[model samples]
Target: MSDIPPLRPLLIERPEDEGAETPATVPPVPDLDIAVPPPRLSRARNSALTRFAMWVFGALFSFVLSVAAWDFVTSLLARDSLLGWIAMVLVGLAIVTAVALAAREMAGFARMGRIDSLRTNAIEAALKADVKAARGVVSGLGALYSARPELAEAQVRLTARGAEMFDADGILGLAEQELLGPLDQAARREVEAAARQVATVTALVPLALADVATALYSNLRMIRRIAAIYGGRSGTLGSLRLMRGVFAHLAATGALAVGDDMIHSVAGGSVLSRISRRFGEGVVNGALTARVGVAAIDVCRPLPFRTLPRPKTSNLVSRALAGLFADADRNEKVK
Candidate 1:
C-alpha cells in the first residue's frame, strides 16, 4: 500500500487506442436440406404394382406364344393330309406337356406360399399365446406332421398343453423344444451331409464342368430335402423360392461374408496344382453348401429364437473348414 504513489485504481475501461472487436452472432437458420423419408405405403404400393405388371406381361407372352404355335401348325400342313394329322398329334403332345408343366409349377408355388404363411401365423400365435390360433396353425401342418408320426403326436400333445397354459413364452418354448427341435436337427444334418457330398465331388471330379454340374445337382437335392423336412416338399419353382429365402436370410445375418471368406481361404490357390486345387475347390464348395443349409434352417424355423441363441456364422464356417481339413489330412495319410 505504500508503493510509490499508491497504484492508481486499476483502470478497467476498454482502451480507446484500439478498436473493440465484437464476436459476430449468427441467428440459427432453419435447415432446409434435411431429407424426409417417403411413407412406407408408397413403397409397398410400388412393389405391388411392379409384381402385377410382371404377371400381366407373362400372361400376354404365353398367349402370344400359343397363338404363334397354332398359326405355324396350320401353315405347315393341310388339315386333311397325313402329315397334318402327324403335326396335329405332335402339337397335342406338346400342349399336354406344356399344360402338365404349368400345373406342376403352379401347384408348387401355391404349396410354398402356403407353408410360408403358415409359419408366420404360427409364430404370431405363439407370441400372442393364442390357444385357438396356435391350434389352427398346428393343425394346418398336419400334412407335414404326417410324414413323421411322432411329430404329429407331439403337435397333438402341445395343442392340449397350450389350452392349459397361460404363459405365451412357456407354450412357445415347449412347442419349439418338442416340435421344431427334431426338424432343426434334421436340417442341420442335411446341410452337413450336403457339404460332405460337395467336398467329395470336388475332390473326385477332375473336370471343372462336371464338378459344377454335380455341385448344382447336390445343392438342388439338398434344398428339396430341406423343404421336405419342413413339410413344404417344393417342386422346381418352390425349390427356387426356398433357395431365394435362404439367400435372403444369409444376407440379413451377414453370413454371406463369412461364407465368402471361407471359400476364398480354401480355393485361392492356382489351378495348375491339380491335387491341391481339387481339394481346395471341394472344401470351398462344401463350405458354401453348409452356409446355404444353415440359411434354410433359419428361414424354415416356425418361430423366431427368443430364448435360444441364433447360430453364429463364424462358428459354422470354422466347424465346416475344420472338418474339411481333417478329412483331407486323413485321406492324404491313408494314400
Candidate 2:
C-alpha cells in the first residue's frame, strides 16, 4: 500500500466494440399452424423400360419383315427369272421365320403382362380383404391352373365360399391354403433339388467353365420348374419372360444379396472364385440357386396370405444349407 498505488479497474472497451449487437436467443417458432401434406401413394413401375424396348423391337422387326416380303414377292412375280425365284424363296422363308418369331414374342409379352396384372390384383384384393374381388380374380385364373384338376376344383369351391364369406381374411386364408399351398410345396421341393444339384456340381467340378455351364443349366431348369408350378408353362419366348421376371423380382427384393452372402458363407469363397474347392463351391452354388427358386415362387404366386404368414428367408436358407450338407455327408458315407 505504501509502495504501490491501488490499481483501478482498467477501462478496456474499444470504440469499435461499443454498440456491438449480440445474436438474440430466439425460441423456436411453434409449427402447430403448419399443415403437413399427406404422403402420396406411388405405384411400383418395375421393368417399364425393358417391356417398352421389347415391344418396340417386336413392332419394328415385324414392320421391316413385312416390307421386305412384299418387295421380294413383287420382284419374283414381275421378273420371272431364276435369280428372282431364288431370292423370293429365301425372302419368303425369312419372312415366315421372322413373323413366327415376332408373333411368339408378342404373345409371350401379352401372357406375361396378363399374369402379372392378375397377380397384382389378387394380392391387392387379399390385402384389402375384399372377398368379392378375390373371388373374381381367382375364378378368372382358372385357365392357369387347368393342368391341376384338383387345384382347379379347389379354386372353384373357394371362389364360391369366398362369395358367401364376410371376413376377407378368412376367405384369403382359405384360398391360399387350398389353392397355393400345394403349389408352394411342389415348388419348394423343386428348388431344394436344384440347390442340391448346384451345390454338388460346384463341389465336384474342378473346371470353372464346366461349373458355370452346370450352374446356368441348373438355374434355367429351376426357373422352368417354378414357372410350371405356377401354371405358367411357357414356350421359348415365355421362358425368357419368366426368367426376366424372376431376376427382376430377386433384384428388387434384395434376395440377390442374400443369395450372394449365402454362397460366400457356404462355399468359403466369393461366387466368382475360380480356385475354390469344387465340392464346397458347388454346395454354396446350390444353396444360392435354391434361394433364387424360392424368390421366384414368391414373385409368381397369385395369392397373398392375409391370416397366414409365409416362410421367412432365414428359415429357407437354413433348411437349404442343412439339406446340402446332409447330402454331402451321406455321399461321403457311401464313398
- Most accurate candidate by TM-score: 1
lDDT computed for candidate 1: 0.65
Which segments of model 2 are wrong by more than 4 Å?
Answer: 1-94, 235-238, 258-276, 307-324, 330-335
Model 2 over residues 1-335: C-alpha lDDT tens digits?
Answer: 39888889988765685556656654643312111121111123559898899899989997997887778777787878787778888887876897788786666556556556666677678678787777667665766676677686787787687778776567667767777888888887778777767666666666658878877888888887776677655567667667776776666655554344554545334323543356555655665686578666765566644444555544554566665555555555576
Q: What is the C-alpha lDDT of each candidate?
A: 0.65, 0.65
Candidate 1, residues 220-258: lDDT per residue as tens digits? Answer: 788788777876675666677677776766666554443
Clashes of each: 0, 7
Pairs with steric clashes in candidate 2: 199-282, 199-283, 202-278, 202-282, 203-278, 203-279, 203-282
- In candidate 1, stretches whose alpha carbon ends up further than 4 angstroms from where it belongs are 1-56, 72-80, 147-150, 209-212, 259-281, 306-327, 331-335
| Candidate 2 worst ten-residue window by lDDT | 33-42
How close is every model to the real structure, measured as TM-score?
0.67, 0.65
